[model samples]
Target: MSELPVLIYDGDCGFCTRSVRWAERLPVRMRILAWQEADLAAYRTTPERARHEVLWVAPSGRVFGGAAAVAELLRSARLPWPVVGWAMSAPVLRWVAERVYRWVADNRSRLPGATPACQLPPEQRPGHRHGS
Candidate 1:
């Protein structure tokens, strides 16, 4: 089989690399890798399009972006984080998420490696790659 849906991220970003590394170790046992280094043309995103956002490509060819992608990834792993994910569907939560999305988009460059993201702290991040 192909693998869990791939997460396309900027490999050069410390936050992106760190987050992918963390996802790589989730109990879900799936592959989620950095797209900047991988051949994901099949995912059919313009480099310009991808640089601005997180991405997820489902087995059925569904694509998700931003907070939706995050929620899908957590649900794909069946992670407890998805519990909060459900709440995110609520209008108020989604409004907050949209605001959060805008802020992340605006400040992604300030992160380590000047990439648009950051890894969560070691203790709070998933344990597979870091070893629980």
Candidate 2:
């Protein structure tokens, strides 16, 4: 079989860690790694980027973030899920999914299974402007 893609997530964030656990239950086989444990350079990603959003790194070193990463992950799953993935990748749904993903990431600290560590630093949160 070919190599599986790598999924990078924040290990310190309880919500993200729990979400990774949930993804592990899926039939698809991929390397789900905590960003803290993975070689970010190998994945062609950075700590800041990984801290800001979930990441999907293809075997070729291509990277996708946020909703796009979620779509790529779903596309790798078994039946019904790939279909959902396709839908999410569609133009309209893709836009909506991006917004939803951003909202979730921005407020994950308040969500179930989240710990105080789940709260991203203010600069890392979405819509945070540099030099503001």
Candidate 3:
């Protein structure tokens, strides 16, 4: 219901929390709320959706998820960030960015600042259940 963009991120993951804190320094005016504290219904998102990916809700009522949401946020930021955002929005680069984002999300617990809970369950991890 806010007139500004809203960045919805996972609160329980230490890596996510750290990343959000870093993102707060971006030169953009937006509200950043943890998914646990957000009104998901207002953003046309469900708890499951929020749990799985970051979301960006625009003032114009557009909702972007995953890497696109990140790109949107960067686009709203100033100067160099917007340049990076434009690169992410490009066709081939966007495809690569999406894949990279998903890989990072799947391996977050192995990343710096991550806690054990940041790791996806074995069954839920990419290629684990499918035996890839």
Candidate 4:
């Protein structure tokens, strides 16, 4: 509800926490919150969606998910980071980035710093259920 943008992620996921730590290292000003503790309804998002992917909720109420959320986070950082963020949002790159993000999200439990909690719930996983 503050003026700063809000970033929501799976708190139980060690990989997600580690990724957030990396994001925190960047010189960006925003609110980073765990989905379990946050009021998802305030962000106009559902718990299921928040559990499944990283989210960026703008102060104005716009929402970005998956790789798009990553791009927005980078855009909030300083200098070269914003450039990288712009590239991520570029047409062809956005397509590639989205797929890469999905791959990472699907395999996060196998990634470094990950814990069993990093694995998505079977019902929330791609192909196992519908909607994004």
Query: What TM-scores do the predictions have?
Result: 0.71, 0.87, 0.88, 0.89
lDDT (10s digit) by residue, model 4, range 27-112: 99999998877888889999778877899998889999999999999999999999999999999999999999999988889999
- In terms of lDDT, model 3 sits at 0.84
> Per-residue alpha-carbon lDDT of model 3 for 4-118, expressed as tens digits?
9999988777888899998999889999988777778888887777778899999987889899999999999999999898999999999999999999887788888997666
Q: List the residue pairs that clash in candidate 4.
A: none
Between candidates 2 and 4, the one scoring higher on lDDT is: 4
* TM-score comparison, 2 vs 4, better candidate: 4
Measured with C-alpha atoms, the lDDT of residue 74 in candidate 4 is 96
After superposing candidate 4, which stretches have Cα over 4 Å from the reference? 120-132
> What are the Cα lDDT values of the candidates?
0.62, 0.84, 0.84, 0.87
Q: What C-alpha RMSD separates each model from the true structure?
A: 9.2, 5.2, 6.0, 4.7
Could you tell which candidate, 3 or 4, scores higher by lDDT?
4
Largest lDDT belongs to which candidate? Answer: 4
Q: How accurate is candidate 2 locally (lDDT)?
A: 0.84
Clashes of each: 1, 0, 0, 0
How good is model 4 by TM-score?
0.89
Q: Order of candidates by TM-score, top first? A: 4, 3, 2, 1
* lDDT value, candidate 4, whole model: 0.87
Query: What tens digits encode model 1's per-residue C-alpha lDDT throughout 32-90?
Result: 65655555567765455455677777766676777777666767666576676676657
The TM-score of predicted model 3 comes to: 0.88
